[model samples]
Target chain A: MWEAADTPNVTKEQLQGAMDQRFSREIRQRLAEARVGIAGLGGLGSHIAVMLARTGVGTLHLVDFDVVDLTNLNRQQYFLPQLGQEKTHALCQLLRQINPYLTLLPQTVRVTEENAGELFREDPILCEAFDQPEQKAMLVSTVLEQCPNTTVISGSGMAGYGSANDIHSRKAARRLYLCGDETTDLAPFRGLMAPRVSVCAGHQANLAVRLILGEETP
Target chain B: MTVTVNGQTQEGCANVLEQLTQMGFDPKRVAVEKNGEIVPRAQYETTPLKEGDKLEVVRFVGGG
Candidate 1:
């Protein structure tokens, strides 16, 4: 239990008031208690993770095995100093800096069929950010089969020449939103650009917030 | 013969390849589902069209 301060102290009302200055107290409360799991810390994942953290999501489960490469600077949040650092670690550090109160669980390991279940057990809302088509397919299939109750929003086909209109929401199944291009051949090897990936991440974050607030997306 | 492309009816000829070409589809990059069954990319050219065939073609692009 927190003690009452002798001097004038910040009350829950004051905290709530401060939150209300920017967002409704109810919305802030919901954001403060939500837990989001982001898989992959690449271009798309970095943006999604940062937005969710800044939005006041209380807990974040960040997973990625790769390090920041020079190429990632074009879009990823990692700075030159953070290059060679594990993406999950770098993103987690950034998230903590953005909101010191945030609880970020960083997993510096690749998500695979063998570990996806265990990693997602702590959080029911998951975001899939893998760039490889085959890996994305594997992650989505495994999550659907193993964590049927959890809501999963995945990114796909965010490459090549396309507009924001290409970013779409498809109901792959009950409680599953497939965000991004649903095309199969848009693998990263086929040339994924920065702006397109960011666009997909924006959609993912928006969809995730809607789901968290108990709203239905078409 | 008749086939459906993206919910639009198209004229299907004896040559499926020529029909696809006429339908403004690039056989190289699109995945074709014929009557709910996925047709392999290799079979796009040789497979013959049939009357009342329903086909779904999905084109892929890259990002993230």
Candidate 2:
């Protein structure tokens, strides 16, 4: 980033060296060795993926069936030029731009109960970012039942214009970390905005980073 | 019988499953926790609850 800002020449080596300087040697090594699976590419998933990439997570298994519609610009991390592209493809391009040497495993498919286990088998952490209540519940239930070793960081209640303080996280179950207010569903009168959604997404990203680093969240 | 559901105190609930239904929750869509332990879906009906027991009924919400 210094080279980009000052010299107009930003090589991968320079980027890595700068990142290494910012993060401790041990943390950078650990982050570069870990892998995570993001189950959606919407508002929460997009932000979490970018945050993880910036932190230098080694591998990413991204799954998303939807395309970038005009409506997704409010909170999703996508450019207007990518309005019609597949979410996985667009996000992969964005990640590559951020980190040229990231091992990205992206697929364009809707996640279901039958395939969620295999999609996330290699990734120890699973992030739930679906846009439907039933879909989120299905993924969470499947992971808890089938993949006992994988930790699921799920979100809910992040809708409407409300207090950012309402968006917080909790350890819902043994392997489930939920981030949201636990209410505040979106209705016709109450819709999702960027501020509150990003707050929940930040919580999810923070929890994921902490879990990967084996640090307890205070 | 007074039991707390979702942090709200309510009366007349026989078990965790009954309480979930009485609170207008679709038992299949929600997950129940009794005293900080998750009650598996298969055991919600059989998991009995007594007075003063706290429960957390959580379900997914549709928002990005």
TM-score, cand. 1 vs. native: 0.72
* Candidate 1 runs further than 4 Å off: A1-18, A187-190, B1-62
lDDT score, candidate 2, position A191: 69
For candidate 1, lDDT tens digit of each residue in B6-46?
Answer: 57898876655666678776655344556755554446678
Model 2 docking grade:
acceptable
TM-score for candidate 2, please give it.
Answer: 0.84
Q: How far is A159's C-alpha from truth in model 1 (Å)?
A: 1.1
Per residue, candidate 1 scores C-alpha lDDT tens digits across A1-218 of 11224334545466556768998878988988999889888888899999998787888989889999998897787888888888887887776665666788888887877887777876778898877665665565556556656787888777765677877876555546677767634543556667878888998898888888888764
Q: What's the C-alpha lDDT at position A13 in model 1?
A: 60
Best of the candidates, DockQ: 2
Q: Ten-residue segment with the worst summed lDDT in candidate 1 chain B?
A: B55-64
TM-score of chain B of 2: 0.87
Model 2 clash number = 0
User: Which residue pairs collide, candidate 2?
Assistant: none
